[model samples]
Structure formats: structure tokens, C-alpha cells
Target: MTRRPIFNRRRFLGTAALGGAALASPAYLRRAYAQSGGEVNIWTYNNFVPEDFQKQFQDETGIKVNVRLVDDQGKQFNLLAAEQPNPTVDIMTVAGHRFLQFVDSDLLAPLDTDRLTNWGNINPTFSESDWATVRGNKWGAPILSGMEVLSYNTDYVSAEEAQTWDTLFSEQYSGQTAYIIQDMMSIVMLMMGYDGNMVEYLDDPDTAARIVEEAKQFLIEKKPLVRKYYDSGAEVQQMFVNQDIVLGHSWNGPAAALITDGFPLGMAIPQEGSYGFVYTFNIANNAPNMDNAYTFIDAVLASPEIGAAMTRASGFISTYKDASQHLNDLERKATSFPDEQLANLQFFRAEANELKYGLVDPAVEAIKAA
Candidate 1:
């Protein structure tokens, strides 16, 4: 995780002082012991782990689960960075690409695959990915996967036209398209003939910068075609359903839910490719309860039962090998891609040079300014 100006020494000191006060408070001490010993604090995006699963895990293991939800992955990185020297949270749910930032900063502990009895049952694509392992040490366990694709209202845009990123710039859809602001850089990179996976070419600084600038220019040029830029999938879905927008960039999960609800929606796999990500569970380096943390992860991955439950709740596919058998036809159809489509999906992995060359944030700021 890159350290931003907002999380400086003064902010850390303030947070630490507040934490000290909380720990010293009589009311807090009265309940601290009960919440500390067998408890595992998790920092994750909202709804990734359903409340029912938390209850089930607590019942089966006798360990208390305290979840702290964040609005996005970037906040997860910021929080972890701020909680330095002594992190209060024990485990975190992070996106695959961002896992490397944690691992590189020594914020995560190497996971023991032996403790995870079901590790062998994880899909090879996830377990074998470079994102999950660094120098032969596994840092996290894969939980779920999803795609960022072009979602269009079938009433205004034909499925055929939606099959390419060019649809975003089409004259027919001018001022009628909404894009997820977070995806602007990747969308521009894909349109510029790059694979959209920055990790693949990070070692080549010249090439990386060239592509970043090209993507930035593309976004600047195409800004006039977009009606609005959204930060949430729900916002994009609402606009699509209301017929306020014909096409937009969206995640597979929410798009699937909207389609199931009878919205005139369809997800398209662009010819250039769609962005893919795997979400993982990582143990904090300063975890107060290591035993409970391992137990929690093991329970989550022990079988297809928990994986299926999570998929049903989040509308994302599980990395559990046998999870498909438990999914209904609609759930499977919404999440899984055909073999050919799967081949075209591009994963965002850890790029050691990302901080130095990444232009996504600047591009987003420029779009917002425009």
C-alpha cells in the first residue's frame, strides 16, 4: 500500500492516542478480555462475508468474529497502512492485485497451506497464480472472483454492439453512456491495444509510461461521450434500469442481480477483454489471535458449502473447485464465463512498478475535473 499525505505521522499519532484512550477507558477494559482472547477482527468490503456465515463460524468454532466494513479496497489499504506497528485487525479481505502491496510492505503473514486442509481443492488458476504467492511463500487464500465488463441496456444497445469497447464512443450512444470511474484507465488501456494488465509490462518503464499517457489522452478525448462517472455499481445499475443510460462499465455480480430482477440488462465480454479479479483473505502481521485467524480461514475454505453460500449472497463466483455443483443455473450463468470468454479475461496482478508508473488515479481526477 502506498502511503498518502492523508495518513501521515500526525494522523497516526492521533489515531494511536485515541486507541490508547479507548484501551484505558473503564468501560472498554471491562469487555476487552472477552473480545480479545478468542476473537478475530476482520476488515473487509461490506457483504463479502454474509452475517449468517459469521454466525455459523462462531457457533462451530466458539470464536467471536468482529467485522469492520470498508467502502472499497483502497480504504482497506489505507486503514492497514495507518494501523502500522500495532494493527487492531487480525484478518483482511483484499483484492488480488492489491495483495502484493500488503505483502511487499510486510503487512501480511505467510499462510500455512497445511493448516488449510482444503487448499488442494482451490481452483488451480487461483492457487497457482503469482498474486497468491511470492518467492514460494503463500500470503493469502483466494475466496471469490468477478469480472469488470461492459453492461448495457438491451433496449437501447444491441448485444452485438456491446461486444467491443468502441460502444462507449459510439455516436448512437453519445451522452447516453455512464462509466465506472474506477475503470477509466483500464478501459482506455484496452482501447489502446495494451492487454490492460499493468503487471505484465511493469519492468519496462518506457513502455509503461508510454501506455499510461496514451490511456490518459484517450480518456481526455472520450470524456465528451460519457454522461456521468459513477463510483458504485448500484449507482450504475439504477441509471441503467431508469433508462437514463444505455451502456456503462460494471461488475458481473450487480449486473447479474439486475438482470435476474427483469431489468433490460446484459453483460458483454468486450473483444479486447474484460478486467478480472480474485478476492483473498490475508492474516495480519500484527494479529492478536493467530490461532483463531487460521481456524476462520480454514472453515471458510473447508468445503463448497461456505463457498456456495458466499457466491449466493454476493453474486460472485467462488474459487472453491466444486462450488459450481451447488449453484443454480442462473447463478452459474451470471458468474461463470464460457471457456472461450474465460480465455479473454485479463487479471490485474501485482505490479512492483505500479506506484511509479500508474496513471489511473490522475486520469480519474482529470475526468472528474472535466
Candidate 2:
């Protein structure tokens, strides 16, 4: 069944531009056009919501969603920080680590659960003090959540054999595994066990550095086996599908993609434990269209039709508990919305500025040098 395209920002913008009267004074017309309870500006990373869901949202709410794409969380945060009281968009989707930073700077508004009717449907995993809570209030609600798992090619090895990080460094799978270019911390956490506790490594800078050295040493020793580290999930998936990789680190989304495509791939949380992050949707403090913004969010979470479409397209666990009943068996199993798995998973904590960036890059570079 082919899905029909519903009205969206581009289509709406094109129509508005074509309306000769509206284009006469671009800035004034723009402001005037946005003043209506018909437009909601959203800032987020690409592919968070499926195109079909965007259309569904527009169709259901009569609110046109204008999404501004940013490449990374840092860039998005920087942009939002610069536009404090008067911002461009009404909402921002930030990852777990970056959300804390935004909260600390007062760049975000207190999330109003009173307006969010689906607030009760939120998974208990997100209710933790360490995850999204700031001063006893939930600042953001998770849209997509996935744990970092060991992704392996089932064709190359049995799932039992590919169960541990130690297997990646084993001689058998040498030259067939890949790692993420930017996930130095997780790699280090898995390698040294952070002196027996992963969170401890993240907390103490000196201890983290020493652990990074240990992780680097492990990686350098296994360099011959690594095909190449990848920056994007698509790249990693391509490599795995082409049979160029036998083992690597990945999240549930990519693994699910491979499985859905009939590839011989599987993902595991590992015996050492697994960590994951969530992307939360926040209303931008200075958004021009507040009513439309609320309408859009409400539609996203409350409307089962839109939520189902979003889950199918984005491969993310729907935040709405009941909406997930619409997902197929495979999707339901892979989704993070299920409290059983999400509750058991370990979440990364927010800390000082240095803890965020300082310990990661240097560790990877040093390992590459050695």
C-alpha cells in the first residue's frame, strides 16, 4: 500500500511563496504568516521523524511543521544558545548528553506535563533521576531510545561465539570487525571496565585517562583486524550487509534495519552490560508559534495513527505506550519503549564540560598512534 503525501513545510512554504501578496515583504509576511496557529518550527537532527509521519502530523493538527536540520548535537545546542529569549523554532530534539548542557544554560523551558495528555504513557525507564529529570521535573520526553550493542554478522559466526567484546579482539574475527569513530568512551568503558565500574571511569578524569590508555592499548593491538571505523550508522550497515564485517558496535536501530532487510545480522547487549541514550523533544524557548508547537507535540504522542507511522519509518520506540501496539512483532521486540529492557539498561550520566569531550578524542588518537 502506497502512503499518500500530506501537506508539509516545503509544500506549504512553496504555496505561501507563490501567493504574490504574502511574498511582497518577506520578513513581515513571514512573521504574519507564522502568527496564525498553523505553523510550528522544529529544530532537530535528520531522520528523527519519518516523512510519512510529518505528513500525518500536518494532516491531523492543521499545523505545518518546519524542521531545521543540524548535523550534530553540539551545533544544534550552539545555535539554540545564541537565540535565547527569541529563538527560531518552537522545539528542539537533543540527545541525552547534550540535554543536560542545554538545561544547565537555561536554554530550555520547563516541560509542561499538564499540556501533555500522554504523559502517563511514558515508560518508567525515562522516569529515572539520572536520565532526563532536572530538579524533579522531566525537561524532555524521549522519542527514540536504543542501547549500544555488539552488532555481528550471523553468517560469519554463531551468535553464541559473537557474544562478547573479547571476541572482537580474537584472532578468528580479526580484520572483519569495525568500531565507531566517535564512541571512544563506550569503547574504553567496555575495555578496562573502568577499574571494575564503568560509571566511575566517567566520574574521575585521572581514572578515565588511565582507562583510555588501557582501551587504546587493546585497540592498537587489534588494529590489524579493524576494517575501518565509521561515523554514520548507514555506513556501518552497508559494510555489514556487504559481508565486509563480522563484528562491530552498533545500536538497535541499525541492527533492526539489517534484520528487516533479511540480512544475517544480530545485536546483543553483552554480558559486561550495555549503555544507551535517548533523543528528547523539547519546545524551543523562543518559538514563534507556541499553540501550533503544542498541537504538533500532542498530535505526535496522542494520535496513534501518526505514532504508528513514525515507529515504522524511524525504527524508534514510540514514547506513547499504546501506539506501539500497532507495530509488527519484529519492531515491537526491537523498540526501546518496553520497560523490561530499557529499565535494565544503563544510562550515561552528565558531568563537567571536560568529562564530555576531554577524555574521548585524546584516547582514540593516542590509541591510533600506538
Which is the leading candidate under TM-score? 1
Compute each candidate's TM-score over C-alphas: 0.82, 0.76
lDDT of 2 by residue, 166-229 (tens): 7866888777888774564564565555532244546567876676656666677777877787
lDDT of 1 by residue, 299-357 (tens): 67766766766675565788988887876776677776667667768777666435532
CA displacement after TM-score superposition, residue 365 of candidate 2 (Å): 5.3
Give the distance in Å from residue 29's predicted Cα in candidate 1 to where it truly belongs.
Answer: 32
Clashing pairs in model 1, backbone N/Cα/C closer than 3 A: none
Off-target runs (Cα >4 Å) in candidate 1 are 1-37, 199-203, 352-357
Candidate 2 Cα RMSD after full superposition onto the native fold (Å): 9.5
lDDT of 2: 0.63
